[model samples]
Target: MTTFYAGLLSPCALACAVALALTGTAHADDNADKNTHTLTPVVVTATMQDSPLIVVTDPKQPRQPVPASDGADFLKSIPGFSTIRKGGSNGDPLLRGMSGSRLNILVDGGMIAGGCPSRMDPPTAYIAPQLYDRVTLIKGPETVLYGPGNSAGVVLFDRNFERYTQPTLSGDASLLFGSAGRSDQNLDLRAGDSTGYIGISTNHTHSQDYKDGDGNRVHSQYDRWNADATIGWTPSDQTRIELTVGKGNGDAAYAFSRMDGVQFLRESTALKWTQEHLTTHWEKLEVQAYTNYADHVMDNYTLRTPDPASMMPMAMAADVDRRTSGGRATGTWRWGDALELQAGVDGSVSVHTHRAGGPPGSMMGYYKDQPRMRDARMQDIGIFAETRWSFAQSQRLVTGVRVDRVQTRGYTLEDMAGMEHMESMSGVDAMAMMPAQTAADRGDTLPSGFVRYESDLSRSPTTFYAGMGHVERFPDYWELFGQHVEGTLDSFRALQPERTTQWDIGMQYHGDRVKAWVSAYAGVVNDFILMHYPMTSMGVDYASNVQARIAGGEAGANYDFTSHWKADVTVSYAWGENLTENRPLPQMPPFEARWGLTYEATQWSIGALWRLATAQHRVADDEGNIVGQDLGPSAGFGVFSFNGAYRIDRRFTLSAGIDNLFNKTYAEHVNAAAASLAGYVNTTRVNEPGRTLWIKLDAKL
Candidate 1:
């Protein structure tokens, strides 16, 4: 396996180059105590507003953007995020404009499911952003207490690991070098005292094949690894107990399908406990539980090469695994001048298994398979409630409700030519001539609601809110085992269950250097699972389900021009309609803008960013739902990035950047589709990568 990943990257790059050359002379009285620890003005975790981080509170915040190389490039800098690219680091995240399973991503709150179906391990590529520390995002469906179906909203990548006071110990480490031959490394550690604490983290990323913007190459190579550990216990001061363990693996190479991506493994374990009793009658109470595991494998000779009409051609292999477990408990109540209450109950269970055989070459190689299909289970149960009322104190009222019960079961112990060779080995030939039934079951009971209204216009610093939400979703697992034609199997058996009714409004303003925010939304969906791709045969691409209607809004602004300079701007737009072929609404996401400028002193800082996009003619011209080619419209581009950071003291810091500075080439209008190699043809638009530079280092003791 590439020499065991080059023997773990040659001693972690020779121990981070001998700790950056013996910490490169840092200590002039620790740079005067790191010049009195500066650089703490960057807040705005998706609005709860508190200015500083260069303003720009909404429009899906992302002002001085262009610093993300993953997590869909930092959620495409907010504003109803958007991504579907199929190159350079598993992209996939589309909000407000929805995408797969309707958003709802969490880490440190569990739930990570992505077993390709052409998704390619997206769950933010198994996270690993230096072990998280905040990345909240809540767009459409506002709030639903982290659990439940999210109509494109809710993305939390939190990680706190409290920092104790006594017997303390800190940690930090990072290294990154980029451009076509990118590289990454990270480490984090923590030890505690004052009652409890423990932590550990690890990460490594690699890249090789990259060349676009006309340079060609493309087939994007990749390698990944992740490790995690956590232990916590706090006996007093509002109790806490936690235990977590994690594992990850990776491989990739797919310039657009025909099988590649050898294996991707993931394992997770979690245990949690929390308590906060402030007496005075039901002040607080909370609890949680979790478990997860996933194992996946794909082959066509591990990362490309053999393609004799792939089904693993001269050599093929396949495997899929799944295991999920969950739990949750909660309670809260407070009354001192109105109401406040919260209640919770959660549940989850998932199990799946699949297997395959190999051989066609290597002298008739070896073969032994059984598990061609049949083994699935799903379950979910929920009960939730939320309330907040203060009908006076500047008007306030929030409400919530939830109820869930979902179930699914399947069993058919291999037969029918191993379920028609596992549906022709994933090319999914309309479910390889169905009729191999043996067992099946299903059940549902879903409901959700929301209401909100807030005010703070009184003292005029501006703050306003309005909300209404309703969601009823069910039918996941890639909409029931990766959509197998027949009009999504009659829209999954006469569809029904996917109701959304939304209306949100927002406003925020802060003074003392200017900060701003604006949010707007409008939704109405009923049985809207929209995904239609007709015109079949030879060009194969079938997916069905219709009935849709969508709208959008986003805006942002910021200005400081002083405190060492600052400026920001943002904008986003979305639209959809397809009331049964009425038109427009095939992977939305267009009309975008972002601007930035920054410069700080006291340590060092510099920044610049600009991005603009527009041009997409909304398409879907049948071809069995065309999987590639015939992407009618697309044109519009702009890109620029630059960053610098310094602060080599109180621990250490240094960051550098350069991204597509002038490389400009672009493509992304919900990209995906680019393989058909025979001189490679098949472009469903997705090519962007050229001109790159990077450097990052951070250390703390």
Candidate 2:
């Protein structure tokens, strides 16, 4: 081991190594074929990268620290990703220290926007990771093929449906039981013939409040479920059509909010068609349309008793809903064997509405009866083209460009008193405090593009890549209409669009017994929209554009010491500077590292993972995005975990794990501050769950 690796070997990590060694390593069969690859039953570290810029992972695979419940949970397994912890679930996902619309999250090529103005329900909250076939992440602003303004990156949750030649029925099911009353059930089934196929998927998960290391209960509990169906027609080898429909509902209790999420309802549908080999040069053409809806409700009295000493010392409820519908059509063409091009046009429209009833008790029963009023509307239309050219035998050039016309309209009426009340309740002035009765509609034309070069080394099994990308992003609903300027009421007209120019470079190495990759990025952001929260009751909240600088890198390596034993390590770090403020950007994640060791045989596997994080001292207090603000400097901590999986037969498998093996209590730096709720202890930040034991059973048919 290198000296740097020796320096990182803490006592907890040593203990993990000792424990794993004492348990004995798996025995490899000498009669088995040496070239036949075996999948690790338990994934302990970061998933492997498919390329220098792309990461692909199986969402159905069993991973350490228990399987994920939401999209944010699943993304955390990848380096350069973190979650803004908001209780147990429904937390916002951050990539390379950026949140909100900067990170474009797409489900099966469709976008879904959350309804809550407070961000109680983010886009990933409605996603159940296990239901998807695969998750793909494109790091940095390296591509414009998807939607616009993906300055941070793009995460895609997709499913694949292959044509069946004969009649077939296939399915997979899983059941889980864990400590703290956690349980989950999932089923995915498909029946198909040569002409058509039908597929159904369902999932339900529930968890009770869990205690921290000190046996203190953290108000983090949730119940969620989802059901989806798909119908596909494969008339020929070159033609395919698919239709999908899905819906889900859930409720969650939060330790970082005064109100609890009482209801989270989602409805979605999509239609897709594709034709391949249309002409000599035309490779394929595809068209897709999708619509998604979210209905979210938050209340103070539904999950727990109202805190009498808080700002809102009475029963209150706010219901908000958003409907987003969009469509895209793209054509792919290839020229001989040297070049390929893809072009597409896409558009979307979103409408947001809300209704609320409040006070001590009078509005409790009538809240749902009140009619909802439209609050805001947003629209986008974009055209994009991407191309790849194989100029040399070992070198390739890739480039893309996109242009989008974005528009927004606000419906909030001028209400000074209501604004003051909202400030007292949420510590932020709302859009109702507009200077005019209603803000005029605003629109902007933005452009984004990127260029990259990739090459394979002559003698080494390594690929080197470098890229530069630029993106112009318009202000979203929360930045434009949801917040006010410090002393100005015309925030809608004051916030300017943000522009980012970034450079990303990386290299990947694939060897006979070792695999490794490293990626790094740096960017200069002009007009970076930042939100400032109130420090006291007399203070006011505001949003302003500022200059910023960001840089980060992630590296991981896997080594197979022997036929059955393997070791892996990963490290990630991100840094940001607010040039306008001349201070560190708020909510930047701290330096983190993970060490994993595993032993695998033909039928079973055992693994150990030790995660470490460095304390963050560079923070701009009270400044951040819509998800959360930095409270102050946070202390760092480490956690250790162990997992094991056994394959009983081809039809069934069992997996189990002990998370936080030492029962260490810790909180993440990029996290929401704890709120003063009625029953929960008021901590600086919401702590993670204590030691947890869980078991899972998977069956394939």
List, in order, the clash count of every candidate structure: 6, 0
- Model 1 root-mean-square deviation: 25.0
Tell me how candidate 1 scores on lDDT: 0.66
RMSD to truth, every model: 25.0, 9.2
Question: Candidate 2, residues 577-641: lDDT per residue as tens digits?
Answer: 99998999998999999999999998799899999999999999979888889989988899999
Where does candidate 2 stray beyond 4 Å? 1-40, 358-361, 413-436, 483-489
Model 1: per-residue lDDT, tens digit, 94-181? 8756776677777788777766555666677677655676676766665667777787677777678763768976666666677777
Q: Which candidate gets the maximum TM-score versus the true structure? A: 2
Span of 10 residues, lowest total lDDT, candidate 1:
52-61
Cα lDDT computed for each candidate against the true fold: 0.66, 0.85
TM-scores for the candidates: 0.31, 0.91
**TM-score of model 2 relative to the true fold?**
0.91
Count clashing residue pairs in model 2: 0
